[model samples]
Structures are given as C-alpha cells and as structure tokens.
Target: MSTVLELSDVTVTRSGTTILDQVSWKVDSSERWVILGPNGAGKTTMLQVAAALMHPSLGTADVLGQRIGSVDLFELRPRIGFASTAMARRVPASESVIDVVLTAAYSVTGRWNEQYEELDVRRASRVLAEWKLSHLEQRRFGELSDGEQKRVQIARAVMTDPELLLLDEPAASLDLGAREELLQLLGGYASSPYAPGIIMVTHHVEEIPPGFTHALLLDQGKVAAAGPIGEVITSEVLSGTFGLPLTVDETDGRFTARAADR
Candidate 1:
C-alpha cells in the first residue's frame, strides 16, 4: 500500500526543549490511525508535523508523498485536511456554516471576494449533508452548539477532498450523546473506501472509532508503542504510556481504558 504519511527519526524542539524525539511512523493509504497520549505527550505536535504545519527540526517528514521542506507548503496544504480546536478558534464566528465549509476549497478560513463555482457549492452541500449539518447551512458558525461546530469543522476539513485528514482531539469538550454520535459518524467514515487516511489524536480510548486500524502511543515526546491497534493498544502499552497501571478493553470494536485498582 502507498504511504500517506512517513516520518523517519523525526525530532521537534522548541526553546531547546524536545517536544518530539526521534519519532518514526508511517500511515499507509488503507489504514486509519489513532494517536493515544496523555496531556503534554506531544500528540498535537505530531499531528502538526503530519499536517505539514510544522517542520521537524531533525530527520525527514513526508506528508501525502511530499517531503516537508522540499514542497511548497502553500500548495501542499490544500491536499491535507486538518481539524483541531485551535483551528476552530481561528475561523470567523460570523461565517455561515456552508460558507465556512466552502472556503476550504480556496484554503481560506474565511470567505473572500473570489467567486465560488456552482460545483463547489454543491460539493460543500453534499459533504455537510453527509455529516447531518444540512439544516444549519445558513446559521452563523458561533450560534451553533459545540457538537454542531465540530461537525461543521469536519465538513470544512473534508471539503477539499484531501488525501490525509488530521483530527486533533475532535471529541474533546463534547457531551456524552454528542461524542457518541460523532464517534459513530467517524466510524462510518473510517469504513468508507473514499475516506482519507485518517489520524486522530485523543486522550481517551473510548473516543476511538471502530474502524481505526493502527495505534501510536506517545509518552513525554517519545513513542512507547506503534503498530496495529490490537497489539499496540493493549493494557501493558497503555500502562507504560500513561505511567500508571491501566486496563484496556475492546468490545464490539470500541475501546475503553481505566486505571487498575490499587
């Protein structure tokens, strides 16, 4: 299978503090990966590198078959979709849901004076409808609930038909019902043949969707485990990654993790 993301001995440093250390991993086109790590474990930093937003200070990073420094990021970015809480804050609140999603075609967070083609509008509508956001097409982005906003962001991310989709803590700050609903949607997307090679960062194992095939466990800027989900997401790896005794469970293709009894 063709690789969508490839990192070899990747290292990221800020102010002489290593955020990611010699991490190496790959996501093939046919697999969906879930990144599991506690806070400050550099999960977001890894996604930023995969999204091509941050270049590694050392080693090679390839995204969508394009090497980071060698490719024009401006041109490469459009082919990679990213959804994160940080990105949500950057998008204008007053923008309409449909407009917010459509602007992604031009790689902008907000609408501009440029005319949008009918085809693009249809495509945006289709994606929103798939995510059950068609009813809120005319609503302002900020007026929606947290769940609604997340769906809109996801719609916006997929608007460009990217080859790789990076989701950073997408289920964060959501209520139980909303999170489950979103998880179901994500599971459906993961099983779809047309879906992009997905990599989601989350702290909770319960948030992992059913079709996620691989796992990457990060601990203090280092990889504790990386491989098939069944192997890497075991209790032992989870315990080591979190620096605490933990038990992992998988039932009906959904995962759950909890601290072991003392």
Candidate 2:
C-alpha cells in the first residue's frame, strides 16, 4: 500500500515545552486508524502535523507524498480533509449548513464572494445527504445540535475528495444517542473502499467506529503501542496510554474500557 502519511522522529515544542517527542508513525492508503490517548498525550499535535496545518518543530513529516516544511502547504492542504472542534469554532454561526459544506471547495470557513458553480452546489447537497445532514441543510450552524454540527463538519471536510482525512474527537461532548448515531455514520464511511485514508483522535475506545483497521495509543507525547487494532488496543495498552488499570471489552467490533479490578 502507498504511504499516505509518514512521520519520523517528529517533535513539537512550544515555550520550551515539548508536546510531541520523537513520534514516528506511518499510514497507508487503505487504512483507517484511531488514535487513543489522555488529554496531554499530544494526539492533537500529531494530527495538526498530519493535516499539514502545522509544521513539526523537528524531524520529517510527510503527507500525500509531500514532506512538511518542504512543500507548498496551500496546495497540500486541499488534498487533506480535517474536521475538529477547533475547525468548527471558526464556522460562522449564521452560515447555513449547505453553505458550510459548500465553502470547503474553496477551503474557507464561511461562505464568501467566490462564485460557486451548480456542480459544486449539487456535490455539497449530495455529501450532506450522505452524512444524513440533508434535513438540516437550511439550518444555521449554531442552531443545530452537537451531533448535527459534527456531521456537517465531516461533510465539509470530505467535500474536496481529499486523499487523507483527519477527525479530532468527532463524538466529543455529545449525549449517548447522539454519539452512537455519529459513530454509526462514521462506521459506514470507514467501511467504504472509496473513502480516503483516515486518522481520528478520540479519548474513548468506545467512540472508535466499527470498520477502523488500526490503532495508535499515545502516552505523554510518545507511542505506547501502534499496530492492527486488535493487537494494539488491548486492556494493557489502553491502561498504559491513560495511566490507569483498564478493563477493555469488545463485542461486535466495538470496544469499551473501564477501571480494572484491583
């Protein structure tokens, strides 16, 4: 499989503090990887580098065959799809859901003066329907529930048929029902052969979609374990990543974790 994302000894430092330390990993074109970690484990920082949104402070990072810092990020960004809370916060609250997805073609947060073609509008509508957001097409971004907003963000991210997709905590802050709905939708996407290679960061194992193929567990700015999902997502690894003794359970391709018995 062709490598879609590659990181070797990648590190990020800010204000004399290191967030990611010598994190080396690679993602291939056919894989969907879920990243698991605690709050300060540098999952988001690694994602920023993968999305070409931030350059690593040291070491080489590559996306879609282009090395970070040596490539034109403007040209590289469009080929990468990203959906995150940080990205969602930039969307205009008054923007209609359809327009929110439409603007992705231009790589903007809000609809603007750029003239959109009929085909663009059709594609946006098609994507909204795919993500089950068609019913909310005319709703303002802020008016929708958290689940609805998440689906819209994902729709917008894939609007450009990007080669790599990055999702950061797509199910965060949602009620149980809302989270399951979004996870079901994500599961369907993950199973699709045509979907782009994906990397999703989440705090909980239960949020991992059914079709995801790989897992990366991060602990304090470094990898705890990384490999096939069934191999790397064991109770021991999860416990190591989160700094707690965890009991991991899996049934029907979904996982759950809790404090282990003493």
Candidate 3:
C-alpha cells in the first residue's frame, strides 16, 4: 500500500519549548491507527502536522506524498479529512445538520450563498445516512446531543472522500453509551476496505474502535512505542505514557486501562 503520512524527525517548538520532539512515524493506506497519550503529549501536534495545519519547526512531514514545506496546503488540505474540537468551534451553531456536511465540499464551516450541485446534495445525504444522522438533517448543529454532534462532525470530515482521516479526541467528553455508540460506528467505518487511512488521537483506551489495526504511544512529545495494537498498547507502555502505573486489558478487540493497584 502507498504511504499516506511520513514524519521524519519532525519537531515543533513554541515559546522556546519543544512540543513535538524528533517524532518519526509512517502511516500506510491500509492501516488504521490509534494515537494514545496524555494531555500535552503531542498527540494533537502530530495530527496537526499530518493534517498540514502546522509545519514542523524542524524535520520533514509528508502527507499523501507531498512534502509539507514544498506544497500548497490549500491543495493538500482538501485531500485530508480532519475532525477536532478546534474545527468544531468554527462551525456556526445555528447551521443545519445537512448544511454542516454539505459545506465540507467547499471546505467551509458554514453554508454561504454558493450554489451546490445536485450531486453535492446527494453526497451529503448519503454521508449523513452513513453516520446515522439522516433523521437530524434539519436540526441545528448546536441542538444535537454531544454524540450526535460528533457523528455529524465525522460525517462532514469524510464527506469529501478524503484519502487520509485525522480525528483528535473524537470521543472526548462523551458518556459511556455515547462513546460506545460512536466507537461502534467508527469500527464499522474503519473495517471497510474503501475507507481512507485513519489516525485517531484519544486519551482513553476504551475509546479505540474495534477494527483499528495499530497503536502509537506518545510521551513527553516522543513516541514511546508504535506497532500492532497488541504490541504497542501493553500495560507497561500505557503506564509509561501516562506517567503512572496502569493496568490494561483487552477482550474481543476492545481495550480498557486503569490505575494499577498500589
């Protein structure tokens, strides 16, 4: 499979402090990866680099075969599907659900006076149906439940049929049932051969969708371990990444982690 993302010794510095330190990683078109790390561990930074939203202070980042510094991000960004709280904040609260997904075709947060073709409208409806948001098409974006809003955001992200999908903390702030429902939806999407390469940043192991193929553990802005999910998401790695003793368990391809006994 072709490489979707490649980060070679990528580093990001802010205010004279390093945010991401010499992070080297690669993602291929056939793999679905979960990024696990505590807050400030550079998970978001990594996604930002992959999404072409931020250029690294040092080293190289290549997304979809285009070098970061050498390419026009406007051309690159359209090929990448990115969903994050930051992106959500830019959406007009009163935007209708269908419009939310439809506007993605133009890479805008709100629908303007631009005329949409019939094909675009059809595509938006299909995406919403895929995410189980068809029933809420007329509802205002802000009126939906948290889980519904997240699903809508994801639908909007994928509406343009991107080659690489980046989701930062997709399940953050969700209740148990809501998180599980979203994970199940994500699992179904990830299992599809037609789905794009996916990189999801999440704090809780339980938030990982079932069909995700690999895991990357980040700590102190560095990769602690990265490989198959079974190998990279061990108790020791989780403990080290979180800077605390953690007990981890996996059953039926789902994972859970918690503080280890004292």
Candidate 4:
C-alpha cells in the first residue's frame, strides 16, 4: 500500500518543552491505526503535523507524497481529513448540520460569503446520509447531543472524501450508550474498502474500533511499540507503554485492558 504519511526524526518544541522527540512513523493507505498513549504523549501534536496544521521543529514530515515545508499546505490540507474536539469547538453553535458538513469543502467552520454549487450540495447530502445525519440536516449544530455532534464532526471531515483521515479522541466524553453507538458506526466505516486511511488517537483500549489493523503505543512522546495490532498490543508492550503492569484481552475483534494482578 502507498504511504499517506511519513515522518522522519520529527521533533516539536514549544517554549523549550519538547513534545515529540525524534519520532519516526509511517501510515499506509490501507491501514487503520490507533495511537495509544497517556496524556502528553504528543499524540495530538503528531496528528497536527500529519494534518498539515503544524510544522515540526526538527526533521521532516511528508504528508500525501508532498514534503511539509516545501509544499503549499493550503492545497495539501484538503486531501487529508481531520476531526477533533478543537475543530469541533470552532464550529458555530447556530450553524445547520448540513452547512457544517458543506462548509468543509472550503475548509471553513462557519459559512460566510463563500458560494457552493448544486453538486457540492448533493455531495454534502450524500455524506450526511452516509453518517446517518440526513434526518438532522436542518438542526443547529449546538443543539445535537454529544454523540450526534461527534458524528457531525466526522461527517464534516469526510465530506470532501479525503485520502487521510485523522481522528483525535472521537469518543472521549460520551455515555456508555452513545460510545457504543459511535463505535458501532465507526467500526463499520473503518471496515469499508472505500474509507480513507484512518488514524485515531485514543487513551482507552476499549475505545478502539473493531476493524483497526494496527497500533502505535507512545510513552513520553516516543514510540514504545509499533506494528500489527495483535503484535504491538500485547500485555508486555502495553504495560511498558503505560508505565504500569497490565493485562490485555481480546474477544470478537474487541479489546480490553486492566491492571495486572498484584
């Protein structure tokens, strides 16, 4: 499979605090990768580089075959989809559901004077339907439940049929029912052959969707293990990655983890 993202010795320093340290990773077009780490592991920072929103302080980042810092990011960014709480917070509370997804074509949150054509409207409708939000087309964005808002954010991300999809804590704060519902839909999307290369950042193993093919564990902003999901998510790897003794279990394509018996 072709590589959608390639990072080599990338480092990000913010006010003398280094977030990522000499990190190297690759994401292929056919892979669904889950980035696992405790808070401050630089998961979100890494995703920013991948999304063309942040430039590394050291080393090189190549996204979508174009090396960052050498290409026009405005053109490069549209090819990649990104959904996160930060992006969600930027959406206007009064924006309609359909407009929230439609405005993504122009990479804007709240619609201004930009004009859209019939084809764009049709595409937005199709994306909303795909994400099961067609019925909520006219609803205000802020009026949706947390789960529904998350779905709308994802729908907006995929509206342009991006090649690389980045999700940052898509299931972060939801009740059990909402989390399960979102996971069910996310699992189906990840399993689709038409879906883009997916990279999700989540702290809980339980939040991982079923169809994810690979895992990347990070500790202190460095890669602890990276490989196929089964191989990298072993008890030993996870224990080390989280700096605690833990046991990992899998059943029916889902996973769970807990502290090791004392």
Q: List the residue pairs that clash in candidate 4.
A: none
Q: What residue runs in model 2 are displaced by over 4 Å at the alpha carbon?
A: none
In candidate 3, position 126 carries an lDDT of 97
Candidate 4 per-residue lDDT over residues 180-212, each given as its tens digit: 988998999999998889999999999999999
TM-scores for candidates 1 onward, in order: 0.98, 0.98, 0.98, 0.98
Question: Which lDDT value does model 4 have at 75?
Answer: 96
What TM-score, to 2 decimals, does candidate 1 have? 0.98
lDDT of 3 by residue, 161-181 (tens): 999999989999999999989
| Residue 12 local lDDT, model 2 | 94
lDDT string for model 1 (1-262, tens) is 6799999999999999999999999899889999988889899999999999999999999998899999999999999999998999988999999999999988888987969999999999999999999999999998999999988899899998899999998999999999999999999999998898999999899999999999999988999898999998888889987889998999988988888998
> Which residue pairs in candidate 2 have backbone atoms (N, alpha carbon, C) closer than 3 angstroms, thus clashing?
none
